[model samples]
Target: MANSTALHSNITQVSVDSNKNIESLRMAYLILLVLCFCIFLYFLTIILSVYFTTAHIRENTRYVLFVYMLINDTLYLVLGFFLVVFNIYVINLPVPLCIVLVILSLTSFMATPYYLAVMSLERYVAICYPLRHAQLCTPQRSHAAIAIIWAVGFSPCVADFIALSSSVETKYFSLSGICGRPMLIKTPMQNNMRYITIIFSFTMVGLIIVYTYIRIMLIARKLSSNKSSAFKAGKTVILHAFQLLLCMSAFTSHFTETYLKDYFAFFPITNFLLLMCLPRFLSPFIYGIRDEVLRKYIIKWHSFAITLG
Candidate 1:
């Protein structure tokens, strides 16, 4: 009787209509849209606040890093907005449309990890040596460094695109939506590369933690400055690491499902929404509360604008 009941439940699930499935997907996207909009507002608030209150804080290399991060946050949020809207509303489009959206989506995701890595290193240096920091971190160099980060970040997307183009139809599933996954089991080479990514991600997080603690110790030994700076750095790195670590685990689990189950059982859109929305919301909160300059600017700009009105 138990076996029969389980079979009935499975049969009911399989018999669900596409329209109902599509409606459920639409609801999911609506929730994601709200999350994306929140990120947009957060990024916009930072940009506006910074621009309006330029008198408060001069543009230094540290500020430049913050601005770069703001730009990336905006790009990520906007891309996410379009991704959720397009996939949910349109549902199906020409196959080429999928390719175009795939490229844009990948452009955001690929670059984000690298930016986190860069920010980790930046914090490491800022905390490690106070005197040499100005020379070590310059706007010209930071911009160039970011450009390099993007270049390296883009290579994987480029290589994978080339691989997709060159592959025969028999090997894998063709791109059907804004995002697609490899249907076949990963090659040994592919798994090796993913493991490398996992390693590098952890290494970046490790450096952030070690340097943060070391900076704390240095500050303690000399009693040079208050503990707040090191505390702020520690919190930021921890948040970023938590997001990236969760994402890495999700990627590994999704791809590593062996032969018994469907490789593509999960909805790509749903998984992405679940993984990303919380980070987007949390990032702006961290920026506003933790960064004194950002916090002051946000308040002052709004106050001044209201007074003018």
Candidate 2:
């Protein structure tokens, strides 16, 4: 009897220790999430403020597209953060509300690569056809392009909703559940659509980026007078390609989680932070710091703010 009681005591102690460790890890994850979000939010505010207040920046087609990307990323980040929190807390949300949130999230997610491709094309035009760049890339045209991007991004969401409506009962939309893609996308048709759309979009964007890079590089080598500008544009396109790859990796996150689950129990959190969050987090820095005009204005505004502080 004494031996059995001792064994029970040891088992109880182990269970308590395990619970404490899990709670500690959860707290740490939450702290990191909040910290990263705050930092990104702060930088986004500064960048967007600069774009909004400056007439020249707002008028330029490149800056206009950049600002739109920033806005889209902000939406994605906010939605993603909320969804992560909801999942962490195991909160049940209204099915309709969750569907709306997921739709917006997916739309914003799809828009990123499209925006990057457009931005690369802009650079390509600016360098490959410098004489026509001004006429080709006006603010009005940029705005129209943005509208087209939104339409394209939301196309998948529309199709998915239709499939969902047909596959599930009317009451399904009325029920409450955890808000996530997996929770809502419950049909084989939805899965196939997702895979097909992702593959097509990524492949097309990859081809566009690669084409632009090669053309810009060839142009850079040919003309001595325009060599510097062409080289700079080539480098910019290369960065865009890198960013696109980062965004693409988010699609493979499920595979990463599946393979590494046993080896690293916190792989989901790690994968989310690294794949989804990090790409958006790096955007402002990649474009803002590298673009000479924006970099100059950012520094000036930063200094002025520091003086006032």
Candidate 3:
């Protein structure tokens, strides 16, 4: 009786351990798969939409700023695709590759918020001071602003690249033929500086939206005679503001995922799809039709399609 009881207890303990190991493995795979799938899908959607949206924009001079926006976004998506795939599935990207990936990833993250700021400021000026709009917001100046935004985003990446290139390999994997590179070589100053840029960009964007919306609301109430124009302008402003706030929320949520969650539960796929890629694609559906010409074109396009069908 004693021997039989001990045998039964041992079997039960083994079964429990097996179940625990299986759960752990399942969770690990889920996290990895989610991260990989989410990033790939996000980048794929952004690149396609960016390409198609800007392809027919003939007036290069007028569309230079938007071109810059698409270019940076394209670069971001392209780079993000590789890093997410390699990091999760392969898990042993080479040291040099890692450096390039990190540079690209950081560059995209830095570039994103500034473009949002520039976009908001452009809308703010267009609505708040239409009299001086032509003089102050010419195509030449727009191009220059876009250039400056990109330059600011690039500066920190350049510094980080210098830091990364100097890193010595800390680990190697013969089977994968890959090596790990140190992440940061800078002190508090560089770290603080980079984050400051992000904070400043997002803040400037938010400030512009808040101030402009308040002014628009008050003006709309007073100038009720220009009600149609005011309504259209107000709608546009709100849409822009909505777009920015949603994007900011997505980014902040992603940052939170790093420390607040466990390794395999990132769910980068679901959050990023809903938050990041969806917004970019969705904004076009909302605002592209708001443009008088684009609205007409879409209507005509749909009619043409219907007739053909």
Candidate 4:
């Protein structure tokens, strides 16, 4: 009778512990949902603030890229949110639709780093070569450069889309399983291509950004006492570097998850959302908050709304 009573007591304790674990998981997800909603609201404010700001912002080439970054970031966040919701709701997505979703996701992922690289290069040229700036970085040329970046960014995704479409196995399209498992599994050749693309593309762009920033800093050092435009330009470049770090953190964390999962086995969904989804929102927020010019505009508009209310 004692043994039977002890077994019952152990079973009850196990059930209580299981319930506590389940409750903790639910609380974590609730916190993530609140964070996601807050980010969405912040994103909308940034978009609206930019839209209503003065013509100077609208006309500037750098700001043009900022706008593109926001749009791309929005697309990225929306796609991520939809995927999570779909996974939770267990809504079945069609095969072709899944392929399209994956392609779009890859395109956004590629465009972000390239955008930051271009922005860094722009600052570098503007700071290091003031004399040739007008001739070299004209509005028309800037637009063309942006177009080229987008095209190059999308190229790898297009290649994959074509390869996937041409595959004899129709099962590739049915990768809509919960936890998004099938998409993570790639052939050895695909893995090689991904590694090569990430290494080559990021290394080239990363080197360019680092070299350009170093040159800009050297120029700033020579005129350290001036407190002129060069100083402001250096500040802007530093902010860009922060944004780049955030962007790269997302990418690195994502790649780390697959390796981490082998050890942890039950990685939380919050990890992916925090690392991948959150960083995408940080770039525009840094731009809006750090730049004096942007800050003034946002503040002015914000005050006007308050007074009117």
Candidate 5:
């Protein structure tokens, strides 16, 4: 009888300890999520303030694309954060709501590479056809391009939604599940379509970046007077390719998490931050600090803020 009581007490202690450990882990993840979100928000606010307050930055086609990229990334991050939170808490959300969130998240996510491609092309035109750059990259054209990008980004999501609507019963939308792409994207057709779209988009963007980089390199070699500008543009196109690669890594994250799950339990969170969030976080610094014109205004704004503080 005494041994039975002792065994019961030991079991209770172990259970309590396990609960404590899980709670601690939950708190740590929560803190990490908040820290990352806050940091991105701070930098985004500063860069956006600079963009909005400066007339030239707002009007310039290149800057306009940069701003759109920033906004698109922000939207992606916000939805991603929410989805991560919901997944962590195992929150069962209405299927319709989850569908909307997933669609928006995916659209914004896909838009990044398209934006990068356009930005590279803009640089290519500026260097290869300097005289006609102004006519080719007008503010109106940039705005129209943004609209087209949105449409392109939404294409895959729309196709997925249509597929879902046809096969899924109305009762399923009324029911709740943990908000995620896997919850909605169940059909084999949806999976195949997703893979094809991703491959095609990445392939196209990669080719565009590669082509621009090569052209810029050729231009840099030929022109002594404009060599410096052409060289810088080539480097920028390379960075865009790097950024596109980072975005593409996100699609492989499922495999990554699966392979690493035994070794690292928090692999998903790490993957989300590194693969999903880090590229976007680096955007402001990559373009804002690297560009001479934007850097000049960013410096002035930083000094002004410091002085005010």
Candidate 6:
């Protein structure tokens, strides 16, 4: 009787272990699948922006800035996806390749918010100072502004890479996860520098967005007596603010994933999707659908389809 009972116990234990292993395997692939789907959505957003946008709209500085943003987001999605797949499959990556990936990922992450802040400022100028907007926001200046955004966005990563420890023991795959290149915070100075960069960049941009919107609201209210145009301007202002909030969510999610590691149950997977891809997926929808000319085209297209049916 004792021998028979032990045999049954061993069989149950083996079954449980098998089930756990299967579940783990399913979860691993599920994350990779999700990342790929997000990348597809990013590509779709870019295509819609390019195809549906009117030539006149494309010529506008604001729209140009947006197109640049979409392009950056696409690059980030592709590069970040590779990193996720590599990390998941435990593919061995050389140190130089790892560093390059980290630089690109960080550049994308940092560049996006600056663009958002600039966008909000553009709206504020257009609504608050309509007469001088044409003079102030010329395409040449916009190009210069974009150049500055890239320069500032990439400066920190360059600084960090220069400061990276020469110690071979500190170099490990454990540092570079799917979400971001490892900070390699080996020294107290490096750790402090990271904190300063995050606080200055994100916090300053957040403040700029908030301040500009507040100013926009005050100006809109003062001009509310105009009724029709004020209503339209107010609506546009609100939409832009919504876009900023969406971008902010991505920023915060990334910080959480990187810093508050213990709190997330599945580690990088949930944080990666919410922080990294969610903005890329949602930004174009918010901007594209709200575009006046694009909306007209969409309505006409829908009417044509219905008539054909």
Best by TM-score: 2
In candidate 4 the C-alpha lDDT for residue 210 amounts to: 75
Per residue, candidate 4 scores C-alpha lDDT tens digits across 1-309 of 999999999999999998778667755775776677576666557555765566767767777777777777777777766766666557877767766676677677777778878888778777887778767766677678778877887787766656555653777566545534245435455556666777787777778777777787788888655446666766776766666666666656555666785654234355557666766756656776666777776677667767988
Task: Give, for candidate 4, the lowest lDDT window spanning 10 residues.
Answer: 178-187
Q: lDDT tens string, model 1, 15-125?
A: 776557767766766776676767567556755567545853434665665566656656765666566566546555445565555555556565666666666667767
Candidate 5 per-residue lDDT, tens place, 1-309, comes to 999999999999999997788668767876887797787777677788888988888889999999889999999998998898888778899998999999999999999999999999999999999999999999999999999999999999999999999988878889998999999976899999999999999999999999999999999999979789899999999999999989988988999887987776566777888899989988988887899998887778778888999
| Residue ranges of candidate 2 with Cα displaced over 4 Å | none
Compared with the true structure, model 5 gives a TM-score of: 0.94
lDDT of each: 0.60, 0.89, 0.59, 0.69, 0.90, 0.69
Writing each residue's lDDT as its tens digit, candidate 6 over 1-309 gives: 999999999999999997687658648755665766665564455445554556776567777777778777777877777776676556766666687887888788778888888877887788788899889887778889989998998898788876774534654634544333553444666667766986788778878777777787787678746545545655665665665566666656656766876654455656566667777766666665577765565566556657988
Clashing pairs in 4: none
TM-score: the better of candidates 2 and 6: 2
Please give each candidate's TM-score. 0.70, 0.96, 0.66, 0.81, 0.94, 0.76
Q: Flag clash pairs in model 6.
A: none
Per-residue error (Å), model 3, residue 231? 3.3
- Please give the RMSD to the true structure for each candidate, in Å: 5.9, 1.4, 6.1, 3.5, 1.8, 4.8
Estimate candidate 4's RMSD in Å: 3.5
The order of the candidates by lDDT, greatest first, is: 5, 2, 6, 4, 1, 3
Model 3 C-alpha lDDT per residue in residues 1-309, reported as the tens digit of each score: 999999999999999997688657645655654565555444444433443565454333223454466566556655654554454354675555665666766666566566665665665565667687768777678778877876777787777655544543444211242222223443555566666766787787778767777776677787747556666766766776777777677666556666665653434543544565555545445554556755565566556657988
Rate residue 148 of model 5 by lDDT: 97
Model 6 lDDT at residue 111: 85
Please give the lDDT score for candidate 4. Answer: 0.69
